[model samples]
Target: MGFLDGIRASKSQSNNKSKPPNNHFVAKDIVFNVDYLEKRFSDCSDIVFRKIKSNHKTNKDTIVLVFTDGLVEGMSINDGIIKQINLYSQIYNSKKINIDLLQNLLLVNEINRSNNFDEIIENILSGNTALFLEGSDEALILNTRGWESRAVEESSVESVIRGSKDAFVENIRTNTALIRRKLKDPNLKVKDLKVGSRSNTSIAVVYIGDITNQQLLNYVVNKLEEIEIDGIFDSGYIEQLLEENTYSLFPQMQVTERPDKVCANLLEGRMAILVDGSPDALILPIGFIQLFQSPGDYYERLVFANFVRLIRFFGFIIATTFPAIYVAITTFHQEILPTDFVLDIAKSRVEVPFPPIIEVLLMEGTIELLREASDRLPIKIGQTIGIVGAIVIGDAAVRANIVSPTMVVVIAITVIGSYIFPHFSTSYTMRFIRIPMILMAATFGAFGIIITWTWLIYHLCSLNSFGFAYLSPFAPSNLVDMKDAAIRAPLFGLKTRPIPTPKGKKSRK
Candidate 1:
C-alpha cells in the first residue's frame, strides 16, 4: 500500500505540472539576440548565423540571419532574401528598421514577423531564416525550407496489382499534395498541427469538411490537443497515443503509405493524420474487417476482387489457427482423424522425438527468425535470404529429424497464409498471437481453440477506435457496412459511406 501510494503521488504530481511560461519577446539589440540564440543552440554545429550591413561604414545598425544550415537553400538566402534586404537598405538608408517596412522590401513569398523568441527559434529550426534588425524588436521569418527526401514510389510494403504507384513521402507538405491530387473538392480540408513539445514536429489532420461529421472532427482535434509528449517521430506514435485501449495488442489505427488510401478513408467520413517525418499516415476508427481491405480491392472487377478477398479472409484464418488445430488433433483428438491420415502422420513422426506442438513451435520460430532477418537485410539480399534460406533450412530440419515431414508442411502453409494480408501490422498481430493459441490447443485440444477464438471475438466486439467498433458491421450487425467488409460487393453496391467514423456524425456522402 505504501508503494502504491507513492506511485499515485507521483502520478498526481506529474498531472499537476504548471503551464509553461510565456516566451520573452525579441530584443532590439542584434548582438544580445545573436548571443542568446547561439547560447540556446549551443553544440548544434548545423546552426548558421550571419550578420550583414546595408553599408558597413555608414550604418551603425546591422541585420542578423539565423537558420539551420542544411535545411535552408543557400541560393534562396543569398539571391532572393539577402540581396533584396541589402538593396532596400541602401536605397532607404535613412529609414528606420521596422517589421512593416522590411516586409514590403523582402522578396520572400512565405514571410511573417514575430516578436516572440520561441516562434523565432521554431522558425529557424524548421528551415526558415530569421532576420533580426538592430533597432527592431521583431524578427522576419523567411521560409526557405528544403532538404533532400526519398522520392515517392510504389509502396514496397503495401504494393497492389492495380492502383496509384505513388506513395506518401516523409515530408508532410509533399504528402498533403498527394492527397490533394486525389481529392480536389473544396470540402477537403487540412489542419496543421504541432505535437511533441521538444521535437515540435508538424502534423496534418486531413478530413473532408462538409462530408465529415463535425462532432468526430472536434473529438479528433481535441484528442490531438490533449497530447503532451517530448517527441513524436512517427505516425505510429500518434496511433498509440490516440488509442482508447493502449493495452490491446491489436492495432487501433490503420497505417498506409498510399495517398489514395487516405483519400478514400477521408471520403468515408474518416480522418487521417500525417506526421512530418513519417511516410505512413494513420487512418482512424478502423474496424477489424478494414484490416483485411486492400486499395486494389476496389480497382479490379467485382468477381476478381471478391475472389481475392475471400482468399485473404480464409488465408488469415488458416494462418492463425492451422498449426494449433494440427497440434490439438494429433495430441488429443486423434480419433477425429481418418485412419490413413493418422497413419501418415504417425509414420512421419516416427523418426522425430518431439511432440506436435514442440515441432510446430520449432519450425515457426525458425521461419519467424528468417522473416525478421530478411526484413533487416538489404532488399536484394533480403529476398534471396527469405526464399533460399527457408528452403534450405526446412529441408535440413526434415532430414535431421528435428521435425516431422507433416509438421514442416503445416508450418509452410501457415507461413504462406499469413503473407496474404497487405497490412503488415495485422500480419504481425496474427504471428504474435499464434504461439499462444498453439499453447492453448496443446493443453485443451479443440476446446482450447474454441475458447481462444470466442474470447477474441468478444474482445474485438468490445473494442473501439475512437468510438468506432473494432468489429464493426459484424458484432453490431450493420447490413449497410457488411457490403464492403469481407466481400467487395460491386463498386455500385457500396452506395453509402461508413455510418460510424470514430465519434463522427452518422451522416456522410
Candidate 2:
C-alpha cells in the first residue's frame, strides 16, 4: 500500500529511515519526518518531495515540500510557490526562523497549519502542497489544487427544448457551482463529507436551510452518514443507501444530471446529494408522479405543460396495463371486443401456434434483449440498430408464425409507452415488470390485472422516501399540492412549495 492506506500493492525498502512510531505527529527534525513520509509512500512514484535549505547568517535550516504529481498545475508551482520560496533567502536574512514570516511569504491563496500525520497525509493526497519546516512540528498545507477536467456541455441524457444548456461534470465543486448559479439565495446550504473508508471519496449535501424541513434534512444527512461501504463510484450508490425501502423496484430518490431540476426541487423544500466524480445528483423525498415530470414542463407554458402531463399520465397507464389487458381480453374476455376488430385479430393469429400470453412474452422478451444489446453497443450504431432490428425482428417473427401480427402491434405500443417516461430508470421499471403483469393476465384475465395494480398501489403507499410519503398528494390527497402533481398550474398559482415548508418560513394557509 502507498500513502493511501489501501491504494496500491507495491512496496520498497528505504535505507536510512525506519517507519515512525505509533505517535503520528510531525517531529521537529525535518529529515526524520521526510524519511517517515518517504517510507510510507515507498513505492508511490507520483508522490514528489523536494528538500530545500534556507539561507541563514550562522546555520541553515532545512524545509521539505511534498505534493502529488499531475494534480497541481505547473504554473501554480512555478510562479506561485517555487519562485517565491527561491526569492525568500535574498530578501529575508534572520537567525531564528519565523513561522508567521514563512506563512506570509507563501504565494498561495489558502494555507492551514497541521501538526499531525493525518491532516498532512490528507492534504497532500488532495492536490495540495505540504510545507514541513526544519524545526517546527506543524506543516503548512497550501491550496494548489488544479487539474484538467471535462468542460461543462449540454446534457446528453436530460436534453430539453427551453432550459439551461449546461450540465454537471464529474467535478463536485463544479456541480455545486452549477446549483449555486441557479439559486443565488443566501439560505442555500452546502455541506461536504468523505465517504468510502478505502477511497475517501468526497460527497456533498445541498439544500435551502430555511425552506427545507429540518426533520427531512436530518434524515437525509443521517442516512448518508450511516453508509459503511468500501467505495462509492457514483451517486447511484448513495441513492440506494439513502432509500427507506431496499426491496422495492421503484426509485425512491430521483437522479438528475440537470442542475435546473435539482434547484427546482430544492426550492420545493427538497434536498439533493452530489457525489464527487459522478455527474448525476440525487433528489430526495420524490414521489411516483415525479417520474413523469421533466424540466421542460416548467419551461413551457402552463397550458402546454398541462396537456403534455396528461399525455404522460395516459402513457403510464398504457405502458403498465395495455399488454396485460390485450392478453386477458383475447384469452378470456374475448366477448368484450368489437365483432369486426375481433375477426381481423383472429385472422392475423390464424397461423400463430402460441397463446396470446406466450406470443406477448416472446415478443416483449425479444424487445428487452434488443434494447439491452443496443445500450451496450456504441451510441452511433445502437440507435439505428435498435430501431431497424426491432422492425426486422418483429416482421420476421410474424411471418414465421412465431408471433401474431396483432401481438407485434401490442408489444410495439407498449415499448413506445415504456419510453414515454422522462426518467430512464423509471421507464425501466415498466419494462422490467411488464412480463409479470402479462403472466397474471394470462392466469386470471382482467381480474388479475386489477389485483396486480391494486397490490402495487398498496406497495407504493407503504413505501417512504426518507420520512415523506412516496405516493404523496395522491394517497394523502392534498388539493394544494395537486396543483402541480399531474398538472402544472400557472406560476402565480403555485405560490405554495410542493414539499412541506420548514416551520416559521411560510404558512401553508
Candidate 3:
C-alpha cells in the first residue's frame, strides 16, 4: 500500500477506538477543584497542597497553593505569596477576595488567571504555583519555576578562546534569555511551540522578525506542527524529524551549543530551533560549507580565520578521499608512483599476507572499533584506551605482518583528518562517505574513486535545507555568497546576506 493509504488505514483503525473523555474541568468551587486535583494526583507523592485561611469579621475564606515539591522555591510561596496575603487579610476587611485584588496584594511578579483544569495541572507540573480560592471560579498561576539546572558554562564542543563563555543550558527560558542578552533588538522574536504528544516538550523558534524570511519561518513552523511523536528528548530528535532529507547522510540542519553561534546565524537571516532540556539548538537553511565554519572565525583576524578555514577544507578532502586514492594507486595504478616509492611499498607489503583492500578494511575496522570504545568509556580511560590501542595495535600488526607500516600511516592520516572538522555530524558523514568510496576503489581502481566523487557531488548539489541549496553558492554559483563559502572574506566585505532570503531583504544593512 502507498504511504497515504497506510496513514488513512491507521487513522480509520484509531477512530474505531473510543475517544478519551475530556478531563478539562473548569474551576468552580474550591472543594470540587481540590477533590479533583487530589484524585488526579493520588499516585504522585511529590505533589504539595498548602491551605491558607483568612477570616474577615463575618466572612471566612480559604486558598490552596498547589505546586510540585522540589520543583518550586518554598521561600517564594511562603515569603512572597502566602505571607503577603495573610498580612493583607489582617490589615484590610473584605467580604469578596477577587483575583485582581489578590494579584495586586501579592508580592509575586508573575500571575495569570485560568479556569481550565488542564492548564492548572500543567502549570503546577512545570514548577509553577497554582492558587485556587474558595468562592472563586478562576485559579491564578504564579511563575515559581526554580528547578535546579546546570549553570551556564563554556561549551566544550564549540569552544573559542576569545568568544563568550556562556553556553545554552537545558532550560528553554534560560536559552532564550542568553540569545536575548546578545541580540537586544526589538525584532528578535521567540515563538513557543509544544511538541511530542505524551512528553509535551517545549520548543522555541528564535529569529529576527524583521530580517527572517516569512516563507522560511512559515515552512519551519508548519513542519514542526506536523510532527506527531511520543516524546522529544533532545534537539537531535527535532533535527531528524524536521530535516527535508532524512535518507541522506549529510545533515540538513546545524546543531550548536553556543548561543553566540545561534545569534550570529539569526542575524544572517537564518532561524534557530531550541528544544527544552537540550543545550544544543538547531540552525536551518544551512549550506554544506557552514559545517566547516567555526565559532572562532568571527573573533580572529580575517587572514588567520581564512587560513584555518582553508585548512579545514583541505582536511575534509583528504579525510574523504585519501584512503580510496591510496588503495586505487597502490593496487591498480602502481606505474603512477615513482620507482623508488613503488619498490619501498612492495618491500613493506612482502611480509604482509593480505591484499591492499583487505589490509585497508582490517585496519579501518580496528581503528573504528577503538575510537568507539574510547568514546563509550570514561573520559580519562577513554583517552588512555585510544592512545594505547592505536600504538599497541598498530605496532603489533606491523610486527605480525598482517598489515604494512605504510598502510598504517595512511589510515592514521585519514582518521586524524576526519577529526579536523568543526562539526561532529559532518565528521560522521565523512566517515560514512569513505566506506563507499573505499569499496568502489577496490572494485574499479582510480576510475571508481572518480565515479564516487562525482556521485557525491551530485547528491550534495541536489539536496536542499528548507528550500535553500545544500551545496549553495557553489552549485547555484552565487559569487556574492561565495565570499563566506570555502574561505570567509572580511566582515565588512560581506555586504549582503546569503541567497534564498526574502527578495530585497538580502542586504545585511
Candidate 4:
C-alpha cells in the first residue's frame, strides 16, 4: 500500500476504538474512595496518603489526607493540619464531629470545599492537601503548595541599564503578583485556565477590563480554549498555537521576562499570558515595530532613545541585506564599486578557491556554530570560546585562502548587526531570512534581492496578530500612531495609544 493509504488506514482503525468514559464521581463511603484512589495511584510512589483515626466519647471517625511527597508544605501538613486536628479532638469533647466544622479545626489560611473526585485529585497533584472524611462526600482542598523554585533575578537576555532588576520567576503566582504590584488598578483582572490534556498546565490571562476591547479579549480566550495538546511545557507552545498563521516565521506574540514590560503592555489594553513553569510571559496583539522596541527606550531620555532606535533600524537593514548586497554587487554589478575598492576586493579574492556564495555560506555557517557553542557553554568559558573561535577561524580561513578577507569582514559585520536586535526572536528571524536572501542574490543578483525584499514587505503587510495588523501604522498608513513606531516621541508629546485599541478609547489618559 502507498504511504498515504497506510496513514489513512491507521487513522481509521484508531478512530474505531471505543474510548473509556471518565469515572470520577465521589463516593460517600471513605473506604471505597480510599480503595479507588489506591488503585488509581498504585504504581506512583510519590503520592502520600496518611489516615488519622479520632475517638471522641465512644465515637470513631476517620480522615485521609492526600498530597504529593515534596510538593506540599511540611509545616502546614504536620503542625497546621494534623497537629491541629489532634489538638482539637483532645480539647473539644464531642461525640459526633460535624464535617462542616472541619474548617475550624485546620489552621490553614485558604480552605476550599469540593465534592468532585477529579477536582480533589487535581488539587492533590497541584501541591495541595485533600482531606476526605469517613461520612461526608465532600473533600477539603487546602492551599499547601510549596516547592523549590529559583528566586526572581535580573533578566539576562533583556537586561537594562536603568530599570527594575526583578524578572519573572517560573512560578505563575509570583509573576502575577509582580505585575499586580505595579498596576494597582481595580479593573486589572487575572483569569485562570487549564490547558494541555495530560500535563494540565495552569495559565493566567491578565488584562484590564475597563480599557481592553471585549472582542479582542474574547478572541484570545477562545483561542486558548481551543488548544488540545497533550503537553504544554512552556509559553512558546501556547504562543505557536495562538498565532493567526502557524506557517509564518514571525512571532505573533511577544514574550517578555520583565514585569515592567508586561505592565506597560497591559496598561495599553493588551493581554498578557503567564504559564506556570515558564518565566517568559506572552503579550498579545503586538505589532512589528514593537518588537524592535526595548523596555529601556522609555527609561532613557527621548533624544538618546530616538538615536538608539534609529541605530537599531539601521542594524536590522544591514543584518538582513548586507551580505546579499555584497554578493549581488561583486558577482553581477561590479561597476557600482569605486576603482580602488573593486581592485582591493579582487586582490583579496585572488587566492580564494570558492565563489562568493560558497564563501558567504561557509563563513556564515562557521559563525553560527561559534554562536551556538558560546550560548551552550558556561558564561565565563562561553565568552572566551566565542572570541577565540572567531579570531582563529577568520584568521585561518584568510591564511588558507578558503575565503576572501573582505568576505570575513562582511560576515563579521552581519553577525554584529543581528546581535543589535533587542529581541532574540527577532534576531533569529533576521538570521533565518538571510539564507534565502543569499540564495536569491547568488541566482539573480540585484533583481533577486529586490524581488525578495518586495515579497517580504508584502507578507508583513498581510500578516495579523490577534486580528491586529502586524505592520500597523506603516501598511495601513496611520500617521497618528507613527509617533511611537520608527521613532520615539517625547513622553509628553505622546497622549494616545497605538492602533488596534478598543473603540472610543484612543487617548492614553
Instruction: Write down the lDDT that model 2 would get.
Output: 0.82
lDDT of 2 at 71: 81
- How close is each model in CA RMSD to the real structure? 9.9, 4.9, 9.2, 9.4
Predicted structure 4, TM vs. truth: 0.93
Which regions in candidate 2 have their CA more than 4 angstroms from the true location? 1-22, 56-59, 93-97, 503-509
lDDT of candidate 2 at residue 189, scale 0 to 100: 95
* Model 3 lDDT tens row, 427-453: 889888999999999999999999999
**In terms of TM-score, how similar is model 3 to the real structure?**
0.93
Clashes (N, CA, C under 3 Å) per candidate: 0, 0, 0, 0
Whole-model lDDT per candidate: 0.84, 0.82, 0.85, 0.86
Let me know the TM-score candidate 1 reaches against the reference structure: 0.91
Ten residues in sequence with the least summed lDDT for candidate 4? 14-23
lDDT by residue for model 1 (283-365), tens: 88788888888889888898898899999989989888999999999999999989999998999989898998889989988
Give the C-alpha miss distance for residue 299 in model 1, angstroms. Answer: 0.7
* Alpha carbon RMSD to native, model 1: 9.9
- Rate residue 417 of model 1 by lDDT: 88
